[model samples]
Target: MSSASLKTIQSHSTRTTPMPRYTMLAVLPCLLFASVVPAQADEHTQPMLKRLAGVWEVEEGMNQGEEIPEKELEGTIMKIEKNMIVTYDREQREVYRALFTLDETKKPVHIDMTTEMKGMPPMKSFGIIKMEEGDEFEICYALPGADRPKEFKSPKGSKVMLFEAERED
Candidate 1:
């Protein structure tokens, strides 16, 4: 073969050859990470929340074409301290925990917490809850930043909880 022809053929073969196995191995992890994501939902659970001495409840929702029958989840809170709280429910599969601070009005300000369902968007909301007479409570600025604050009532009494929703505006 002519020297130039041989050089051209060599260049074509080099360009078409498979990459080294080590290079492929190094790229596999990156490919997996591109397709895989770590999921964090229940930042905490019901039994986890029961540490706070209070009341708790859960309301059920319905699916498409289904009716939401009246169902209540009875829960209780066992107070751990002035700044810490936990709640547990009747079924006890769920628990919630909260670390609290204070607002200017001295209202309880939630610093951050795990009183939310799994599969929700990662979030932290600051708000206060005040209890009134009867089975009533108020979430001021509660679920404020969140599009919807999931609600739950305390079984021991009425420490109504409104959790941040999994949504980004």
Candidate 2:
């Protein structure tokens, strides 16, 4: 995605009743990354995509160097299926919908997600993903209009969001 597209996504007005901070920070990246697993994934990516297709619960996350308290992440859920990702808040209300593409050829697995939140313009984001042992995985992504993050850290001054999730299904 081009920088201009990212800028357009970031330029939209904020919602009047904003989503909870943790909901937005912790679940958005996962939603975006998970949405990209196409059903027709190539041979090289099929195994990884198969592993990612399921229901997940956010276990922990950090955004722009601030930790997302566990209390805030409670009840957040992400469901992934064949290139589509849907995210729900604690109340079980859908908060985001996105489509994603994955490039497993990259060392850490590159992902590009295009998300459309209610009443907002679609936003495109880039990030890296790592699948860990036994149904655990992590994703680190940049905010709309920011450069893709090179590492998994979301340190101070970085526009990155990092999340670790575990399969719930």
Candidate 3:
């Protein structure tokens, strides 16, 4: 073709049209939202969370090899909803709430719980959990700032606590 026509074609081919600012603004939020939504949805859909979600009554508990008194255990309840765990006392008063994460790939299912209490700094505890038959489960965890427990036991002066719970009907 003519040189002028060829140059015009080349220039047009090399040109890049800028996306409109308003379109980018709108698309950026959607992109951010899309990126976030899947992670949140995936967290809720985790198989472990599905199995753990429910109300549970604390059947037995031990701390530092000392058993918690039966009276203290009475009327205590735990509720796992999504990734949150809420515990209530004998009077049904909220005791503490924690956000938890599970690593099911680990042999004994690793758990990390972060609790925030009013007037206190956030505390993170590491633990291992075992799901048993007949809707019973056990958890053994170290206190905040301590190493994760290697087993489901709270030996004397171990700074670990173990709890056995049964799912409520």
| Per-candidate TM-score against the hidden true structure | 0.33, 0.71, 0.71
Model 1 TM-score is: 0.33
Show model 2 residue runs off by greater than 4 Å: 1-46
Error of 2 at 138 (Å): 0.3
Give candidate 1 misplaced runs (Cα > 4 Å): 1-70, 75-80, 104-123, 134-136, 140-169
State in Å the error of residue 24, model 3.
57
Estimate the TM-score for candidate 2.
0.71
Candidate 3 residue pairs that clash: none
- Estimate, for each residue in 84-168, the C-alpha lDDT of model 1 and write its tens digit: 5454555655455555544434434223443444565544545454443433334423332442223333222222334211111
- TM-score head-to-head 1 vs 2, winner: 2
Pitting candidate 2 against candidate 3, the one with the higher lDDT is 3
lDDT of 1 at 122: 41
Backbone clashes (count) for model 2: 1
lDDT of 1 at 6: 71
Clash count in backbone of candidate 1: 32
Candidate 2 C-alpha RMSD relative to the actual structure: 26.4
